[model samples]
Target: MRARALVGAALLAACSSVTPPGLVLDVGRTCEDIALAIADPDVLPGWKIHAAALARSDEDPAWYLASDNPDELALRRVPEDMPGVDLSALGGPHEFTLTRGPIEGQVWLTLDREDEARLWRVDEAGETMLAGPQLTGFPADTSTGWIRRLVFLGQSPHLIALPRTTRVGEVPVHMAAVSPELALGERWTLTAEVSCAPLSELNCPLLWEDLRTLTVLDVAEPGSVAGAALLVSIASLGEQPDPQMPPMFQTHIISLTVQRDPSAERPLLTRRDHVAWSTDGPVLPSPAQIAADPLGIYVLAGLVPAPDSSGANATTADYLFRADVLGAGTSGDSGVIALLGKDLRSHLLQLGSRVAIGQRTGDWWHVAPIEGVTIEEGIVGSLEVGDRVTLLRAGRGQVVVVGDAKPSRRVRIACADPDDGSETGGL
Candidate 1:
C-alpha cells in the first residue's frame, strides 16, 4: 500500500502514461502455467509447416520458419542491396492452417517494406485480403510493414504479436496462456506489449503499464457470446516540461488478430494485423460485415466512459480531440489552454465558439463562471454536483504540446447534487 501510494504521488508530480503496478497477477504462478500450456506444442499446433526459415521457437508453429506452400522452399535470405521496385523475389506467399480446427490465413511479404507484411484469410466463403482488427464504431488502424513475432492460443485461435528490438538481452514485457476447449469460449491470454510510442513523442515515451484484452470468441455461438476487453496505457510524459502552449494531441490505433494459445487461465492477446496502404480510403468494408474479425463480431474490449477523477463513473456529454492551431498567437492559445484545464473547470474557455458550462438540475442548466467550479486542491478542480461544463472538448486532464486522437472518447458524468441542495452558480 505504501509503495502504491508513492507511485501515485510520483504520478501526481509528473505526467506518465503507465507505471509498473503489482503483477496483474503473480509471476511465479503465471510462469508455471504458461510453461505447462506451451507444453502443448504451441498455440497454433499440429501443422507441419514449410516456408523460408523464420525466427524459430520450439513452443509453437506460429513462430516456426514458414513458406508459401507444400512443394516450394521459402527464401530465407534476400539480396543485401537491391535496386528499387523489385517485387518478384522479396519472399514467398506464406500460408498457414491448423491441421485441425477452423484456422486458415496467408501473408505476402514485401521485403522492401517490412511493416507491409500483407495478410489475408481464406475460408469456405472465399479468399480475400484481411485488412485489420477493426473495432466496432471506431476507425480501422493499419500498420507499417513489420511482423516481429506470432503466437496462437486457445481451442479457437487467438494471436499474440510482439515487436522486434535489436538488443539481444532485452526482456519481454508480457506473458500469456491458453487452454484447448471444446466449448465456444476459447480460453487464452498472450502478454503482448502495447505501447504509446506511435502516439507519444520521444520525449514523452508512453509505454504500457499492462494492457491486454481477454477475448471470448464463441465460434458455435458466433456473436452471441463473443466480446473483448482492453486496458491501454494513458499518454504520459516521463518528465513535465515548461508549458508555453497547450499540447497538441492525436490518436493512433493498432489492428490486432488472434494467433496462438499459451496454456490455461491466461490473458488472451489479439494479433497485430498488417495491410498494404490504401488511396481509396479504408481498405476494408465496415467491420460489422467482416468475417473472422474478432472486433466487429465481439463487443469492444475496453471499458466505456472511462473511470472519473474520483474513480467514479464519468460524466461527459461530448468531447473531441483538437490540435493546437499552428501560427495562431496567444489568442489561439487561449482556447487550447481552457480545454486542457481541470474538467468542468474550464468554464472561462471556448473552442470553435462554444465555451460555457453550467449547474444542472433536472432539465435546467444554470450558467456559471470559471471561479464558480469547486476547486479540488486549489490547483485541480471538479464540476461538482449541480455544476455542468461546456467546451469544445475535455481531454484526460492534459495541456499536451502533442497528443493523439485515439482511445479518446467523451463520457457523461452523473450529476449528484449536494445534500443541502444549495445552489452556487446562477441558473
Candidate 2:
C-alpha cells in the first residue's frame, strides 16, 4: 500500500499541466457550438463537455471549469479565435438535471420547477417529450419532499421521492411517493402514491423512516417486464439516551419487488415490499448510496460513527453483501462480502469483472478493489493496460471511462488471484 501510494503521488505531481479558473471563448459562440466542438477529437480528446447556459448568466461563451484533481478545480478557457456554431439558444426556459440514459447516445432529463418536477426524454435533435409523471407540489429545496434518486433500467426510469414530515394537528406525519415501472414513450397515468407499491396507502404513515438512496438489483424477465427487484435505504431517528444530546439516526435497507398485475390489462405493475435482510446495530450512516450487481448489492457509507465535533469530516467505506443469502431480518454482518478501509471513497463501479474503489489523498488518486476482485498493485488514476479513469461530465450518472470530471474515476479489475491463479466470485 505504501509503495502504491508513493507512485500515485509521483503521477499526481506530473499531471498538473492545465491551471485556470474559467473557460473564455470567442464572443459569438453559443453553448451548443462549444458542446459540438468539444466532441471533435481534434478539439478536446478524452474530455467530455456538458453544455448548458450558466444559470446566472445569459451572455454568450459562458464560463466552464476543470480540474487536475476533482477537489482542486480550475476554470479554463477556450481560445477566443475559434469559430462558433449558429445556434439560437443554449437551453430552454426551465432548469433540469441531465443524466445519460442506459443506452449510448440517449439522454434523460429531470425538469426541476418550483411547482412540480417532471421527467423528459431528449433526442439527438434536442427535442424533448414527457417520459414520466410530474411530481406535483414537490418543494424543490431540502425543506420539503423532493426527488431523491433516479435509476434507469433498460429504458425504464424509476423515481424515488424523499419523505417529507408535516404536522397533522400536533403530531408529525411523514409522506412520500414514487413513479415505479415507468415505461418511457408510453402513455402512463400519474398519481401521488400509485408507485409506492404495497405501501400505496394514502395514509401509510411512512413514519420516521426517511428514504435515502436506492438501486435496482435485477429485472426478472426483462424481455416481458414481468418483475423487478430493488434495494432501498431508509433512515429513522435513533433512541436518544440523553434528551439534550444531538439526535442520532439509523439506516435500514429493504428489498422491494414489482411484478406485472395479473388483473390489470396492458401489463400494469404491482409491487410488494419486504425485509429481505438486516444487519446488526447502526451499520449504515445517514444518506448512504446503494448499487446492485449480479453477485448482490453494495452500499457505500461510514463504517465508523461520525465525528461529534464540528468542522471535522471523514470519508466513508464500501461494503458488499450477498443477495441470495440475505433474508428475514438476518442478524450479524454475515452477509458482508467485504469491508473496505475508511480512507477509500464511495461510488463503486463495475469495470469489466471487478468492482473498483477510488481513493484521493491530496493531489494523488488511487483505484483499488473492494470485493472478491484483484487490481494490479501500484496502479494509480489510470489502469496499467491503458484503461484510463475519467469522469463523465456530460450527465449525472456514475463515472464512465474517459477524461471528464464528475464525482469519481473508473478502472478494470481482475477476478482471479495472481498468486494462486484461480477464478473467484466478483461483482
Name the best candidate (by TM-score): 2
Best by lDDT: 2
Steric clash pairs (candidate 2)? 20-75, 21-75, 22-75, 22-76, 23-76, 23-77, 24-77
The digit string of per-residue lDDT tens for model 2 on 351-395 reads 322234455443334454333222223332322212234333232
lDDT of 2: 0.33
State the weakest 10-residue window (summed lDDT) of model 1. Answer: 1-10
Tell me the whole-model lDDT of each prediction, alpha carbons only.
0.21, 0.33
State the lDDT at 236 in candidate 1. 17
Candidate 2 segments exceeding 4 Å error: 1-96, 112-114, 125-149, 158-162, 165-233, 237-247, 253-287, 303-334, 352-354, 368-427
